[model samples]
Target: MKTDKKKIIVSVTNDLVSDNRVHKVCTTLYSMGFEVLLVGRILPHSSEVKRQYSTKRFQLLFKKGPCFYAEYNFRLFLYLLFAKYDILLSNDLDSLTGNFVASQLRNKPLVYDSHEYFIEVPELVHRPKIQSIWLWLEQKILPKIQYAYTVCQSIADVYNKEYGTDFKIVRNLPLKQNYKPAEKQSDEKIILYQGALNIGRGLEQAIKAMNNIDGVKLVIAGDGDIREQLHDLVLQEKLHDKIQFAGRLPLEELAKLTATADLGLSIEEDLGLNYRFALPNKLFDYIQSQVPVLVTNLPEMAAIVKKYDVGEITDSLEPKQLADKFREALFNEKKRKVWKEKLPFAAKELVWEKEEKVIQEIFKGITR
Candidate 1:
C-alpha cells in the first residue's frame, strides 16, 4: 500500500522521542504507509528509544535557557520552506505560525492539533494580557485552517461552538492491551502517577494522602519543573519509604511497571478548562493494564470512570478525603472487579483506531 507521492510534514515543538503525541502519531502514520517528514528538536542520544520512521530534526543550540519563541519560529519557518512537503501538520500554537506560512507558500492543506488550551496554561493563567494575546491569535488563525482536531469530545465541542469550526476527536489512547502478571507482589500495593509533575496535577495531594495511609507505595515515573519541589516535599513530610521517584523511565519500562501497579492516578485541579476536561493518556494506560483508578470528579473523566465503574472519583480537594477514597478502592475487591470488567471494551473503543476514519474523512474534504 506504499505510495510514491509526496510526504506529509508534521511539525512539533517538543523533543519527538519523549513526547507521546509526536511519538504515537509518527508511528501510526508509518503504519498507514505515509512518508512522514517529521520536524522536531533532537534530544541527547539514548539507547532506550530507537525511532522507527525517518525524521528531519532542527536541533536547538541551547538545551536549557529562557523561552526563545521568536528564534524557534524563525528557524522552523526556514526549515519548513526548504523541506517541500505536500501537507502541513502543526502540533500546537508554538509551531502553528511556521505551519501556516508553509501552507500558504506551498498551497498545501493545514491540520492544526490543539493538545491543550493555550490561553489557560498554568503559567499564563495569572496574566490576563498574555492570555488575551493567545486568544486573539487563535481567533485569527484557526478559522482559515481547513482541518482541525483535539484530544477530547468536550474540547472539540468547545471549538465547534466558539469558532464555528468542525474538529475531529482524537483521544490519546494506548496502542496495545496488556494483562497483569500472574504473580504480583501483594505486600506493596503500587499507586502509579505519570505525566508532567506540575502543580494542581494532584501530585501534592497524592503525596499528602500517603501521610495517612500505610502499606501503599507510590511510583512517580515522569519529570517536570515541579519534580524537585515534589521530591523536597516528600523529604519534608518524612514519607520517603512510601513514595519513590522513578525519574522518567523509558516507555517500555514504564508500561511494565504500570502493569504491576494496583491503581492508577489522574487527578487534576479545575484551575482551567483544559485541566478541568483532561482525559489523560495515563488514564487509558491504566485501563489497558487492567488497573483501577483514583480520578478527579471532572465531568469528562467521570463520564468514563462512572460508566465503566473502573474506579473512584472525588471532587473534594482535601488530602484526607482523597486518602479515604484510596483506602476504600484498595480494600473493595468487588468494586474494583466491576471496573476491571470493562478493560476489553475500554481498550478497543477508546484508542486512536476510532479517530483514523474521521481523520481520513477530513482529508477527503480538503482534497475534494
Candidate 2:
C-alpha cells in the first residue's frame, strides 16, 4: 500500500464515508498491486473517514439539483485532467460525465460502474426533461466505451441491449465473514432494515405493519430523503418504542446489530425498473451477518433468497399482509433453522473476494 505505486483514480459524487461499495472497489484495486486515489465530495454533515488508500473530497457550494451536478462535474473534470493516473473509474452516471470528458482528453482508460439504471430510478422517472438529459449522455457515451460493469445481470442486460456495450457484473457483495449463528434467547425480536430510507423502499409499509405484530422491534438504519417523514409517521402511529431509528452507523457497527436480528427486510416496491431489478448491498450484508432475509418478489432480490434457501419472498406491499409474512419469516422455526444454517453457504459464494476475478478480468483488458 505504498503511495508511490499506483495508476488508478476513482471518482464518485457522494460523501465518501457511507459508500461501502466504492470503498471496497478501491480496496480491491489496491489489493491488485495498484495504488488508488479515491476522489469524492464532502458535505457539511458528512462524517470523517479513515482508509488505507488516498482520498480527496471536494467542497461544493451547491448541495443538490442541476447546479450541483454542473459544478461538481466541472470541478472533477479539472481535477482528473491534471491528476496523475493512467485509468479513471467512475461510479454511476452522475460521476461519469466529468470522468468521461477527462479520460477522453487525457487518453486514459475509463471504467464505468453503473450502480443502477440511471434514468429509471424513481427520482428521474417522473421528470421527462431531466431524465432525457441523462439518457442523452448515456446514449452518446456508453457505446464507445471499452470497459464497464454494473451491480446485477438484469441491469447489465438492459445496457448491453440498448448501448451494445459489454458491461460485466460486479454485484454489491460484502467481504467474506467468519460469523457464528447465535441462538435466540429472548421472545422479543428485532426485524432489521438497513440502507437508504428513500421513497418506494417499503419502509412505510414495514413501519405500519409493526402495529399488528407483537414483541418484535423494527430497527431502521441509514438516512435519506424520507427520513424525517418516516420519523413523523412513527410518532403519529405511536409505535415509537417498537420502531428504533438507529440512523447511520459505521460499516463495522451496523453488522454487529444485523447479526442479532431475527429477520432482515429488503422489501422495495417495484416503482420502476430500478427497484424491480434491484440487488442492494443490505441483502448481502444480512447474509454475512447470518440473518435470514425477507425480500420482495422482485427478480434480483427474490432470486438470491430462493437460490440460497436463506430467506422467503413476499408479494404484498400492504401492511396487514406484510405483517402476516413477517410473522411467518420470524416465527416459523423449522424454516428459520434451515435459513440460518444456509446463510454461511450463501455468504461464502456471494462475497467480494469471489468478485475479484471479474474485477481482474475487466481491468486486464482495459489496462493493457
lDDT of 1 by residue, 1-368 (tens): 34455478888866665577667777766665667777777667623346777776666775543355556667888887887666788998878887887778878889988887667767678888877877887888887877898888988888888889888887778776546463676777888998888877999988999998888998898888899899999999999999999877778888888888888899888988888888888898888787888889997888988777778898885889988988888878788777667766776676666656666565545544
The lDDT leader among the candidates is 2
Per-residue lDDT of model 2, residues 9-74, tens digit only: 999999888899999999988887787898899999888889999999999999999999999999
Q: Score candidate 1 by TM-score against the native.
A: 0.93
Clashing pairs in 2: 6-35
Q: Give candidate 2 regions above 4 Å deviation.
A: 1-4, 182-186
Per candidate, the number of residue pairs that clash is 1, 1
Tell me model 2's lDDT, rounded to 2 decimals.
0.91
Number of the top TM-score candidate: 2
